[model samples]
Target: MNIVETQNLKKFFQSKKGTVKAVNGVSLNVIKGETLGIVGESGCGKTTLGRTILKLIKPTSGNIFFDEKHLFDLKLNPRKAKDILDNDGIDPKLRKSFEKNKYGLSADASVSKKGPNSWRIDDDRSTYLVKGEENSMKVYSVKDITDIDDKEMRKHRKKMNIVFQDPVSALNPQMTVYDHLNRPLVIHNMVSSEDEKLRKMVDILNTMGLKAEHLIRYPHELSGGQKQRVCIARALCLEPDFLVLDEPTSALDVSVQSKILKLLDRAKDKFDVSYMFISHNINLVRAISDRLGVMYLGKLVEIGETSDVFQNPKHPYTKGLFKSVPQPDPDKRVKAPLTGEVPSPVNPPKGCAFSPRCPHSKAVCERENPDLIEAYGRKIACHIFGKENF
Candidate 1:
């Protein structure tokens, strides 16, 4: 089952220069129980795509469905309530009150304030109302919470949580680690009583390889690795089915990076968590992710099982990314790094965004963009995959 799905999702930022297409026509599905890694260089819209799926950013256009439900079509059912009132033998006066209050309309002879600066009168005789007068008000025609209502979205937030990069910045300076983890559990009603909360907090700290004493210490008192562990513990407190790990180990030392990766892997099994792991480190992605999606300039160039992507890269951009990784063997020769910087998202290339930096750019590559197609059971967006040598 796909827990999350996005179809032709797009996000555009309007600036003085022009419109920046941060995410353009991106569509992907996150299987219910697998870690899907999204790897790309910085500013490739990897973070933007993750946030947009979580509804942190309102998509410019497209649809998102969660667990087979249309997220955009959520609304209070009015007809069902009418049927209940008619058949349930409820008092007619109560029904009138329910209709008036539920829909946010005026029951008596008074003006009803609607939305911003809009007003309507209940009396049949009234043609107009005073401009500045306050009237009975009700919330009607609520916009999508991803667009307007944030508090409503909080109910579903526990299902999807994100662990951002920079552990120090992500954690509070004043609060102790114990307080940090306990707060979310308490706020989300994950625990029953104070004792249970404390016990669970201590257990979580231990699972993250931190002693209970360390929980009393503030984030500043801990090392970079320890701070990251605390951040991981905080994310795990939600017990979320899907986690967005945004560069979780990017800021740590190499040695500490290994430990964090191992901890994440262990946590996945213990908690049965699925992740959308976003990072620039291909080596780390290869180690932890079961599947990989290579992103470039707000578009996915290639995606497949981890081994297939690493062994036989289909797209030029994917090949370039793999070549850029430094090998440890002394006898192995290193290829030159990817040529040219990533193109501007505001004004991407005419056709293939990576054509400027691609080594195998052809006439068709510059003239038309390629759609993401499946070949040999792998998804790739390159025109040269099945074409003859030019």
Candidate 2:
């Protein structure tokens, strides 16, 4: 079961020069009780993608499904997207059309627009409102939360959370560790009394290998590792079903990084949570992730089982990333395969973003971008690999 899923996710920013595609058409999922690691270069939109999924920054367009429900679809008109609670009152023709498409619109699906106002169609006919389990006619009661009011969204916030890269800046200077951990509990009404809150905070702190006494200290009074532990404790206290760990250990010491990683591994099973671990360290991602995704210029170039991807990278960009890793034995070192600098996101290359740097660039790779095609039990976006497999 997937805890969270994104379909055609995109996030763009407008500057004086042009529109920057921070995250372009990223589609992935985090399975329940599994760690999905995402690795890429510094400006590849790893952090932006993580933040956008948590709704810290709104997405330009896409769909975010959480716990088998449509949590967000920015393109959908919330005012008109109503929850089809039951099959009762639905037009037979519309129901049949939706059934034929398997609860989603197909490319050749000829759905009429003579239904209720809630049932709307876009000009491009790429999206429709009705969706549900495959082959099941029963519709969900909760509607898409694209335009949901802040108060309503607050109810879903506890289910999703993020741990930023910089722990120092993530914590409050004036707030004590106890205050930081207790705020989420109070806001969500997770505890009935102050005593219960205190007990819960102490238990979570202990789980992070911190003493209860440390709670009284402010952020300035703690070490880098301690501060990160506090952040982890705070995120765990909410008991979120999904977490976006954005380079959680990058700012810590080498020794401390291992300890933090171990704690995170333990927390996943203890809390029954799924994670989207975003980092620049390929080795670290390989060590902790069950599945891995490689991003380039805001798009996923390759994704598959961690070990399989590391052993055999299909995409030209993914191969370059692995080759770029430093070798401890100088005698075994090999020259990196990739060349040229990354193209500016404001004006990316016409075809695949990595074509400018790829060694096997061809005329077709420069003319048109290829879709993510499945092969060898993995997904790769490159013309070198035929697209018929998907």
Q: Candidate 2 lDDT, tens digit per residue, 1-390?
A: 567767778999999999999999998878888999999998999999998888778889976656754323322233322333223344344445455645643444332232232233322333343443323332221223444567877888999898989999999999999999988999999999989999999999988999999989999999999999999999999999999999999998889999999999998889998999999998899999999999999999999999999998888888888998876687968686467888899999999888888888899899999887677888888998635453
Best by lDDT: 2
lDDT of 1 by residue, 1-390 (tens): 456656567888998889999988786767777889999998899999888878888888855545432112112244432333234243344335435544323334343432233332333322221112133212222112234357867877787888888998999899999889988898899999889888887887888888989978998899999999999889888888778899999999999999988888888888877889999988889988888988988888888899988998878888888888887677765667788999889999988998999888889899999877667677888888733342
- RMSD in order of candidates: 12.5, 7.4
- Candidate 1 — which residues are off by over 4 angstroms? 68-148, 386-390
> Candidate 1: global Cα-lDDT?
0.75
Regions of candidate 2 where Cα sits further than 4 Å from its true position: 69-143, 329-331, 386-390
Write out the backbone clash pairs for model 2.
none
Ten-residue region with minimum lDDT total, candidate 1 = 124-133
What C-alpha lDDT, on a 0 to 100 scale, does residue 167 get in candidate 1?
96
Task: Give lDDT per model, in order.
Answer: 0.75, 0.79
